[model samples]
Target: MKTQNLTVKAVSRGLTLALSTMCIAITSACANFSGIHDDRQMSTPEHYTSSQSLPAERGHWPSADWADQFGDSQLSALIAEALGGSPTLEQARARVAAAEAFSETATAKTLPHIDADNALTRTQYSANALVPPPYAGSWQTENRGLLSASFDLDLWGKNREALKASVSQTEAARADAEMVRLTLTEAIARTYNRLALQFVLHDMAEREVRNREAINAIESRRVASGLDTEVQHKLAQTRLSASKSKLVGLDGSIRATRYQLASLMGEGPDRGLSIARPALGMGNDIRLPDNLPADLVSRRPDIVAARWRVVSLAHEVKVAKAEFYPDINLSAAVGLDVLGLGRLLTAASRTASMGAAIHLPIFDAGALRAQLKGRYAEYDGAVARYNQTLLTALGQVATQIAELRTTDVQLNDARDAQNATRQANHLASLQFQTGIANQLTVLDADLNTLAAEASVADLEMRRRDRQIQLAAALGGGFVDASVAHPRNTPAAVAAR
Candidate 1:
C-alpha cells in the first residue's frame, strides 16, 4: 500500500513538471490583438445639464402608481387589465426567460464537468488471428466503463468574462420588460382620455342640433310674417343640416375611440361597447426629479437596458481578447477495461489516466485579430446606443415639460372663453323674456355657448393627456436595483 501511494505521488509530480515546462515554452507564442484601436465613446449626464429648458429646482420622481394621480378609478382599472392580458408584455417576459437561460448556460461552462460512459461488444476470434492460447477460436464479450472529468484552466478569464456578459444581458432584458409595461400603461391612459374628449364633444353636438332647430323655427316665423327673406330662412335650414352632420361625425369618432380603447385592453370592439365615458382629471403640474440628467440614466428602462448592453459587450470584448491567448485544459478518466464480461468489474480490469493539454494557434491567418476587432466594434456600437438612449430620454422629458407648460396657459384661456359665452347666453335669455331680444338671438347665443363649452372640455382632456405623456417620458417610475452599484460602466470597461 505504501509503495502504491508513492507511485501515485510520483506520477502527479511528473505531470506537474511536464505541464509547467510546456506552459513556459509556449506562453510567448500567443497571437496579438492589441494594435487595434477604436474611437467610440459614451456621453455623460453633463451633456444634458447645459440645456436651459429643464427645470432648475428640486422636485419629485413619479411613483409606481403614478396613474392613480389622475384620480379616475376607471382609468386605473383599464391600465391593470391591459398589463395582465397584453400580448406585448407577454412577449417581453418571454425574452427575459431566454436571456436567463443563456446566462445559466454561460455559468455552467465555467465549472468542472463529469460524465459516465460505457460500451460492450461481442466477437468471435479466428484460429489464424493474433490471439494465441487454448481459446484462440472461442467467442468473447468485451466491456468497458468510464467516468471522465474535464476542466478548462481559464487562466485568462475567458469563461469568467462570458458569464458576466450573460448576467448583464439578463439584467438588460429585465429592464426591457419594465419599459414595455410603462409603454402599455401610458397607451391605455391616453386612449381613455380620447374617449372622454369624444364623449364631451358628442354631447355638445347634440346641444348644438337642438339650438339650431329652435333657430329654424324662429326663422320660419319671421319669413311668414314678411319680416325676413326666403334666403335667410333657407340659410337657417342649411345651418341646421350642418349641425346634424357635425353630430354624426362626432358619434362616429366616439365609436372608433372606444374600439381603440378595447384593443389596447387586449379585447374586442364588444368590450368597448361596455366601457363608460372616462372621468379622468388632470393631475398636479409636472415636476422634475430632484436630480435631473445625471439620475435620469437609471430611472428610464430603455437607457438602463442600453447601458447594460454596453456593459455586456464590454465584457465580450475582454472574452474575445482572451481568445487570442492559449487555452489549457485538464482531463482525467477512471474506468474498467476487460476482454470478457466476467472480469469487467474485477481489479485486474481497473485503469486510471490523467493529463493536461495546451492549445496555441501557430498560423490562424489573422482570424483571432479579426474576431477581436469585431468584438471591439460591437462594444463601440453598444456605447453609441447607450448614449443615444440617454440623450433621447432626457430630451423627451424636456419636451413634455415644455408642452405641459403651454397646455396650462391654453387650458386657462379655454375656460375664460367658456365663462364669457355663458354670461352672454344668460343675458340674451333675459332680454328675450323681457321682449327686448328675439328668440333667434337667444338661440344663437345658446349655440355659441355650447361650442365654447366643448372647446374647454377638449382643452381639459388635452392637459390630462399631456400629463400622462410626461409621466411616461419620466420613465414611469422604473427603478433598477443594479444601477445603485454597477460593477462596470461602458467607459471603464472600454479602457481595459
Candidate 2:
C-alpha cells in the first residue's frame, strides 16, 4: 500500500510537469504570434513614385465621352456595342466573381462551425455461468443525438492573413477586368479608324479610275482627229487599267476591314455591317496639354493590378512565415449514452467532454524551412515584376507623348503639301485648257495633287489613331475622384 501510494504521487507529479511544459510551449507560441506586423502597414510599399507626370486636365481629349472626341456617332456606337457584348470582358468579370467567392470562404473560417449528428443502435445479450445477470436474456436499444460546435482561436493570425490575401486577389481580378475593358475599347476604336481610312482610300481609288477613263476618252478623240500619237493613247489606256486594278484592290481591303470589325463586335464573319465614311473636315483646334501630372500611373488599371499583386505576395509571405508557429485548435461535444432510446436525453444518461489540440513542428528534415525560402523567393520575384510593370507603363506613356508631338508636326506639313499641290494642279489645268501646257504636264500635276491628297488623308487618320492611343494610355477615360475603390454600378452588378 505504501508503494502504491508512492507510485500514485509520482504519476501526479509527472502529469503536473507535462502540463507545465505544455503551458510553456503555448506561451512561447503566443509570444511569437504577437510580434507579427499588421498586414496594412507591411503590405503597402515603402515608397511609390510615379516615373512621369499625370495627364493634364486641360488635355486635347475631353474627360467626358472619350469616344465622341472623334465626332463620329457610329464609331461611338460600335465601341459601346463591343464593350457590352465582348466575351473576353465577360470572362474577366466571371473571374472577379470567383475571387470574391473565395474571399468569402476565407472569411467564413473565422466563425464557429456547428454540426448535428444522431445515432441509433440495437444489441442482444446472453447470460454466462461465470457472470451474474439481472435477466436471462435481454435486448437493448441505444440512441444518441448531439449538437457540436468548434472554433479555432486564430492566435497565429493565419486565417486573417489568408483572408487578406484573398481580398487582395479579388481586387487584382477587378483591375484585370477593367484592363480588359480598356483594351477592348482601344481595339474597337483602332478598327473603326482603319475602316474609315480604308473607305476614304476606296473613294480616292474610284475617283482616280474615273479620271483615268475620262483621259482615255480624250486621248482616243485626239488620236481619231490625228492630233495624238498611238503611244499617247496606249499610255492613257495603261493608266486607266492600273487605276481600275487599284480600285479593285481597295474594294477588297474595305471588305476585309468591315469583316474584321464585325468579328470584333461579336458577330459572324460574313455579317453585313456597313461602316459609313467619316466626314472629311480639317481642323487643328484641339489643344494638347504641355505638361502632364504625376499621379496618372496609379489610375491605370494594369498598374493598379500590379500593385495589388505585390500586396497579395506580401500576404503570402506572412502566411508562409506562419508555418513556423504551432497551430491551435479547440473542439467540444455533448451527448448521451443509454440502454433505451427514451432515456437518451435525461440528466442521468447525459455526458459531455471538451478538448484542445496543438500541432507543433519540431523536425521536418528542413522541408518547412525550404518551403519558406521558396515563398520568400516568390515574394522577391513579385516585387521585381511589380517594378517592371511600372517601368513599362512609364515607357508607354513617354512613347505616346513623343509620337503625338511628332505626328502633330507631320500633319501640319502634310496639309501644307496638299494645299500647294492643289494650287499647282489648278494652274496646270488652266494652262492645258488654253494650249499653254501639254497633256503630259496636266497629267503629272493631277497625279501629284492626287498623291498629296492621299498623303493628307492618311496623315489625318494616323493623327486620330494616335489621339485614341494617347487616350487609352491615359487610363481609358479619366479617373473619377469619388471612386476610391473599384465600383460596379447597380446595372453592371445586376448584369453580372
Candidate 3:
C-alpha cells in the first residue's frame, strides 16, 4: 500500500511539472507577440522631395486611366479584353491558389490530428483435453474499435514559424499575380501606342510618295521641252521610285504592328480588328510628377514581392533554429473490445490509453547545424536581393524622369524645325512656278521639308514611348491606400 501511494504521488508530481512547463511556454509566446512588426507603421515614406524644375509637384503617378488619357474608346475596350482573356494572368492566379493551399497545409500542422478505426474477426478453437477449459470453445467472435488523437506541442515554435513562413509565401504569390497584371497592362498600352505611331508614319510616307510623283511629272515636262537635262529627269524619277519603295516598307511595318497589337489583345494574328488613326493635336501635354515619396518602393508589385520573400526567408531561419530544440507530442486513444457485438459499446468492455513523447536531437553528424547554416545563408541572400530590387526600382524611376524631360525638349525642337522647313518649301515652290529658281533648289527644299516632317513624327512617337516608360516606372498609376500594402490588397492602377 505504501508503494502504490508513492507511485500516485510521483504521477501527480509529473503532471504538475508538465502543466507548469506549458504555462511558462504559453506566457513566453504571448510576450513575444508584441514584437511582431505593425505593417502599417512601415507604409509611410521617411522622406518626400521634388527634384526637378517641372511645374507638377513631386507625388505619386497620376491615377488617370491610361487608355482614357489617350481619349480612344476602342483602345480602352481592347485593354479590358486583354486583361480578361490573357492566359498568363490566369496562370498567375492559379499559382496564388496553390500557394494558399500550401499555407493551409502548414497551418494544419499546428493543430491536433484525429482518426477513427474499427475491425472485426472470427476465430475457431479445437476442443482438446490438454487445453484449458476456457480454450475449449468451438468458435469465438471478436470486435474492436478505436478513436485516437495526437498533437505536437509547439515548444520551440517550430510549427508556428513554418506556418508564418507559408503565410508570407502566399502573400508573395499574390504580389506576383499583381505584377503579372501590371505587366500585361503596360504591354497592351505600349502596343497600342506603337500601332498609332505606325499609322502616322504610314500616312507621312504616302504623302511623301504623292509629292515625289508630282515633282517627277514637272521634271519630265522640263526634260521634254529641253529646259532640263536627261540626267536631272532621271534623278527625279529615281527619287519618286525611292519614295514609292519607302511607302511600301511603311505599309509593311504598319501591318506587322497591327498584327502584334492583335496578338497582345489575345486575338489571332490574322484578326481583322482595325485601329483608326489617333487624333494628332495633343502633343507633350502629359505632366509627370517630379517629387516622389520613398514609400514608392512598396507601390511596385515586384518590390513588394521581393520584400515578402525576405520575410518568408526570415521565418524559415526561425524554423531552422527550432530544429535544435526538443520536440513534444501527446497522443491518446479510447476504444472497446468484446466477443459479443452488443457489449462493444458498454463501459465494462471499454479500454483507454494515453501517452506523451519527447524527442531531442543529440547528434546527427551536424546535419541540423548544416541546415541551420544554409537557412541563414538563404536569409542573407534574400536580404541582398530585396535591397538590389529596391535600388533597381529607384533607378528605373530616375531614368524615366530624365528621358521624359529630354524627349520634351527634342519634341519642341522637331516642331520648330518642321515649321521652318514647311515655310521654306512653300517659298521655294512659288519661286519655281515663276521660273525664278531652278528645279534642283525646289527639290532640295522639298527634301528638307519631308525630312523635317518625318523627324517631327518620329519625335512624337518617342514622346509617347517615354510616357509609357514613365507610367511603368511609377508603378502604373496613382498610389492608393492599398498600394501602401501591396501584399494584402490587389488593387489595379490605371497607367495614365
Q: Please tell me which predicted candidate would have the highest lDDT against the true structure.
A: 1
Maximum-TM-score candidate: 1
**What is candidate 2's TM-score against the reference?**
0.80
Instruction: Assess each prediction's global lDDT (C-alpha) against the native.
Output: 0.85, 0.70, 0.71
Error of 1 at 109 (Å): 0.4
**Rank by TM-score (best first):** 1, 3, 2
Clashes of 1: 0
lDDT of 2 by residue, 115-177 (tens): 888888786667754324653366677687777878776766778878877888898899889
Candidate 1 clashes between residue pairs 3 or more apart in a chain or in different chains:
none
Candidate 1 structure quality by residue, lDDT tens digits, 266-325: 898898888888787778767676667777777899988998898898889889888877
Q: Write model 3 residue lDDT over 149-265, tens digit each, in one string.
A: 999878778899799789889988998888887788888777777777777777777877777887888888989999889998899889889888988887887788778767776
Where does candidate 2 stray beyond 4 Å?
Answer: 1-64, 121-141, 219-235, 270-274, 279-293, 336-339, 438-443, 478-496
Alpha-carbon RMSD, each predicted model: 2.3, 8.2, 7.2
As for TM-score, the candidate ahead, 2 or 3, is 3
- In model 3, the runs with Cα more than 4 Å from the true position are 1-56, 121-141, 278-293, 432-447, 478-496
lDDT of 3: 0.71
